[model samples]
Target: MEKEHLIDKYVQGTISEDERLVLEKLKLEDPDIQKEIDLLSDLKIVTELEDKTDLKNLLKETEAKLKQGETKVIPLFKKAKFWIAAASIVIVVAIGITSLLNPFSPSLDELYAENFEPYKNVVNPSVRSDEDIDAEKQAFITYENGNYSEALTQFKALYEGTSKSYFLLYQANCFMALSNTKQAIPLLEKHSTEDTPLAIRSKWYLSLAYLKEGNKEKARELLTEVISEGGFKTTAATRLLQKLD
Candidate 1:
């Protein structure tokens, strides 16, 4: 079977027993292939830290709006029913305007910016080491520092040597950070169905990548899949899908 097809079947848990045997044989003979499998399985621990700081700011803004509205008092001569109706209209209008002006709904770019944080580095030493290191280590250091160009170059070179899924995933993320969604898309899709650690999350990121590429149909399709799969990011996928609608 073709490598891509085999990978998808295996990841989706639909590979036949014979196909599983074939994949197992190939995995045994090729170190790089086995490394790819292992890395994908390992990357499953990835977690996103919500940016609550922004949420806090939003709450503060809402409070300020409410406080400002409270300052207005109707004169005793005003009709009570008219004042009540006017107050209700003002509240409804304020809410509608707030929703319309929400920074979160502005564009896919803003949504991507809100959600596409780099997966924290799990491969390299947390601190600089004293010993001589390989290209992967150097690549991660540059990546951790947000140097996408250098990190991409290094990751590309490392993948040529290791052919690991982690390298491919990180390389794709580098392309994403550099606004090269075309370059990132195929790489992320390659292992999008694999049962590896990053598999489900890869679909989520791939959906974002589709959004970045302005393919809302593709984005919605993948987001739906992510939501149906229902694991680490179903809530996030739901939120994104709602925005797309």
Candidate 2:
């Protein structure tokens, strides 16, 4: 089946179970298809809402004309239209109230700031003793104290010394804190598909890195993937995608 045919069936709510599954999979893999579906849905809602408003206005006009005896007989078509319009008024009013109550106004940067917080030092002890520790330990202290430049330097040293993936995640976050998303992107991208604890988190942060870099398209792509994969980040990713849309 063609995309157009599938989409038509989707809109009509007549798609087979297998076709629905296939369309949903396509939607996940293709952002353009998802966007088209969203647009179609929105258009249908607005058209229905507008039709309701128009019907109400038309009924008022018709009633006024009838009272004034403007015309002798109401045409069969007018009577049918009037009854149809009256039947839907309740439904329309309910929909109108719901739509007015929940409006969508998404701010991408605000959402990012609200959602992005540096991961706590769970890999290390939350509280440090008086021991003179190594560079990695010192780096955590700098990071906790909000000295990102020093933290980045220390984290780089830790990576050079050990080549650990955790260090890369930490260093990438430091760059992000400094608003250096360009530098953070590659590091996060490296771990996004890995099986490490930070893998899913890396995908989330990578999307944010793209967002901060003004790459909305790439950000949306990653966020969509995060939503599809389904995890702790799904809700946040879905919210971010709404704003991006």
For TM-score, the strongest prediction is 2
lDDT (Cα, tens digit) per residue for candidate 1, span 94-174:
555456467665598888888887766877764655477667777898999999999999998888887787777888889
What's the lDDT for candidate 1?
A: 0.71
Q: Give the lowest summed-lDDT range of ten residues in model 1.
A: 40-49
Candidates' TM-scores?
0.56, 0.57
Poorest 10 consecutive residues of model 2 by lDDT?
70-79
**Using alpha carbons, what is the TM-score of model 2?**
0.57
Candidate 1 wrongly placed segments (more than 4 Å): 1-104
Off by over 4 Å in 2: 1-107, 130-132
lDDT, each prediction: 0.71, 0.71
Clashes (backbone N, CA, C under 3 Å), per candidate, total: 3, 0
